[model samples]
Target: MTLNPNLRLRRAARIIVLDPEGRALMFRYDVPGRPPFWVTAGGECEPGESFDAAARRELLEETGIIADPGEEIARLTPEFITVEGEPVQADERFYLVRVSEARIDTSRHTALEQRLMTQHRWFTRAELADWPEAVFPESIVTMIEQQERAR
Candidate 1:
């Protein structure tokens, strides 16, 4: 699909938050009248913000977590339509973080997220591989495997 000429390129920072048991946290977005999908917790970097800084801020904003974002693990650029009907070419950098639990506080979600996000869950790699619903970063299983091998 052609990107919207009116929108600028988007640089997003995403966090792959895992628990001690290695299950990854994902946000379940269920837009009104639309099918649901799981996504990582993060957003586009604002002006004057570094990718790492934006990742940290978004992680807290989306999940109320305040852990170090650590290092960038993978980068992918994908083109997709936004919830607002805008076509976005997103340059996304994914960071890996291990959290203690899967619980999240949604009070910090922005107006947009608050409207779209329905729930959150921690998925084991095997579960993710077998998930019947759609998940962003389609190669999540491979990414987790790489992170595991590195540890």
Candidate 2:
């Protein structure tokens, strides 16, 4: 995909939250005007908030899970156009997060305006690999593979 020069690139944080079972939390976001896609626990950086703080806040707000952010696992630039076909880009910072528990509460999420998240699931590395096309960016898949290999 071609990125438009006039469009600004934004920094976002993504958490690879893992439980004892080696399952990572993922969710399917159904965008009203775009194709559905799956994503890890994360969101855009809030003004004046640190990346780590934004990551934790997004994880809690989106999944209602409390976690302690761990070391930075990987960094990627995942580019995609918005639903309206406008050029967009995200400089995603991926972090490994250790959570004592997982919850699916959406009570505090206020950004469900344009996207409806249908289902949230915990996926193993193998399961994620079996996902259909374009479910996740290639860079993210590579990062996950590297992490798995290191384990």
Candidate 3:
């Protein structure tokens, strides 16, 4: 499914927080309105919040994780079809962050209605590559590849 060229999509940012072992912290959601996919911790920039601040806030909220914001790694505005087959548009910015610590605390996430993810796990780059179809975003794969090449 492709997005309508005339549709006006809003912009958002997603941060890929990596551990020392090259594992990335991601959020999994199976809500009714959104896709059942695991994505990097991020969201739309709130008023007066810089992109990095938004990223940090998303990380802390969704996964109970915190990281020092890193460089902007990659960007994409991939279009996706909603569960109802309607074209949903999004402009996404991807950032790299090095995490200092992460712990799961359900109390931190009151906004998410999804039951599939109330905790976080570490996933190696290879593990992410081998994820089942439609489970994760393609931008994650790109970020892993870039990290590999930089090593």
User: Model 1: runs farther than 4 Å from truth?
Assistant: 1-7
Q: Write the per-residue lDDT of candidate 2 for residues 91-141, one digit (tens) a residue.
A: 777887756665567777665623476777888777777877345644555
Each candidate: how many clashes? 0, 0, 0
- In TM-score terms, candidate 1 sits at 0.91
Tens digits of per-residue lDDT, candidate 1, 1-151, equal 3444566689899999998899999988887666788998899999989999999999999988998899999998788777777788888899998888777888998888888887888999998988998899898889989989998
Off by over 4 Å in 3: 1-5, 33-35, 47-49, 81-87, 101-106, 113-119
The ten-residue window of minimal lDDT in model 2 covers: 133-142
The candidate with the higher TM-score, 1 or 2, is: 1
Model 2 spans with C-alpha error above 4 angstroms: 1-4, 83-86, 111-115, 139-141, 148-151
Task: Report per-prediction Cα RMSD to one decimal.
Answer: 2.5, 3.0, 3.8
Q: Which of candidates 2 and 3 is the stronger one according to lDDT? A: 2
**In candidate 3, what are the lDDT values of residues 1-79, reduced to their tens digit?**
3555775564567878777777887766665765456777777677676667777787677666666566667767777
Please report, in order, the local distance difference test score of every candidate based on alpha carbons.
Answer: 0.87, 0.72, 0.66
Every model's TM-score: 0.91, 0.80, 0.73
Q: Candidate 3 — which pairs collide?
A: none
Clashing pairs in 1: none
